[model samples]
Target: MFKEMKLLKPSWITALLVIVLSLLSIQNYRVLPAKEDIIFAAIHWHGPVLLTQTLLLCLIAWQVVSFRKIRFLVAIRGKDEVIQKNLLKLMTMEVIGYFILFDGSYLLTGHPIFSKGPVIIGILMLVLRMVLVWFLGLLLITTYTAPYPGLILLGVLVVNLFYHYVIEMNFLLIQYSQTYDPLWKAFNLNR
Candidate 1:
């Protein structure tokens, strides 16, 4: 029965999980006034993480999917000549998994980033992040066939830098003050 059913290689899931785990990581610390109590920070969790590093994660996902071995590469070996025909399916699955796992963790932990957000905004935040990552993965993979891949990579780097400094889009994961959060009441949905 196991053989009859399709199973993905463990490595693909491993690589996808690594990205999710990294994003969901908590940054714990204590301020001078709260020295005795460790605080699980929302902004501190991923605030300092550079956008370039996020792009690197996308690149890593691309590289992992490009692996040739049985463990890293499977489920795309169709009779058709196009080896990457299932690339969209694979990327969509990875993004959905990334959203569910990370957001689910946020929901359970009551992280201020997730807990203090309105239901609609919270859902939108997850969706936007996943869409950007999915697009980046596809962009990175497209470069493989380009003649001057380095130039394209450099251009991508510039855009990421612009987004990091100018646009300043950080997955809407902000740390709202406990007492002043207008959306705090919406946290019931999280629980």
Candidate 2:
């Protein structure tokens, strides 16, 4: 079973996976109700949250598939510890990036789905966005030799940046720039 797997093989399939996942995220975002204010935007956090979670799940699947390939390679090519270590590190970073994305989205959207409190949500989200970007960087580096993978990573970066700057940041800025009295009164946050 492992013998059939190949590292950097089926590059188009991986690229397609990335595209499908991103489109799902964008679809979730697009479905939200339009509102002037971020706090009262009538947006349900579940869609985006679930979508992001799905992306993470896909990444895990990729990791497993890649591991199978690595195992096959190890068996035939004399067990390169460095490749294994690097793969593990990349997977770890991807997991960490997912957590950051979740926390950040939660905070930026004003805890729409879960009420985990506001203290660390923003900070975590900022870190998560950075981590997500970093994930793309790693993807680009790892898949640079493969045209499809590199192109897919580039596409993901473009989409992510578009969403962050055009949509997410707009809402965040609105949330931050407004007077606190109305927001505090609306959300019942004592401050």
| lDDT (Cα atoms) of all candidates against the true structure | 0.44, 0.46
- Report the C-alpha displacement of residue 69, candidate 2, in angstroms: 7.9
- Misplaced by over 4 Å in model 2 are 1-5, 35-44, 65-76, 85-127, 130-191
Judged by lDDT, which candidate is best?
2
Q: Give candidate 2's TM-score.
A: 0.40
Per-residue lDDT tens digits for candidate 2, residues 1-191, read 33433433434554455545544544443344443232222122434433553465446445544454345456577654545455545555554544444344434543253232252544455455546555654554454224355356547656665656555445643443333234545776554
Best candidate according to TM-score: 1
Q: What is the lDDT of residue 4 in candidate 1?
A: 15
Off by over 4 Å in 1: 1-81, 112-117, 169-191
Error of 1 at 76 (Å): 18
Query: How many clashes would you count in candidate 2?
Result: 1
Whole-model lDDT, model 2:
0.46
Write down the worst ten-residue block by lDDT for model 2: 35-44
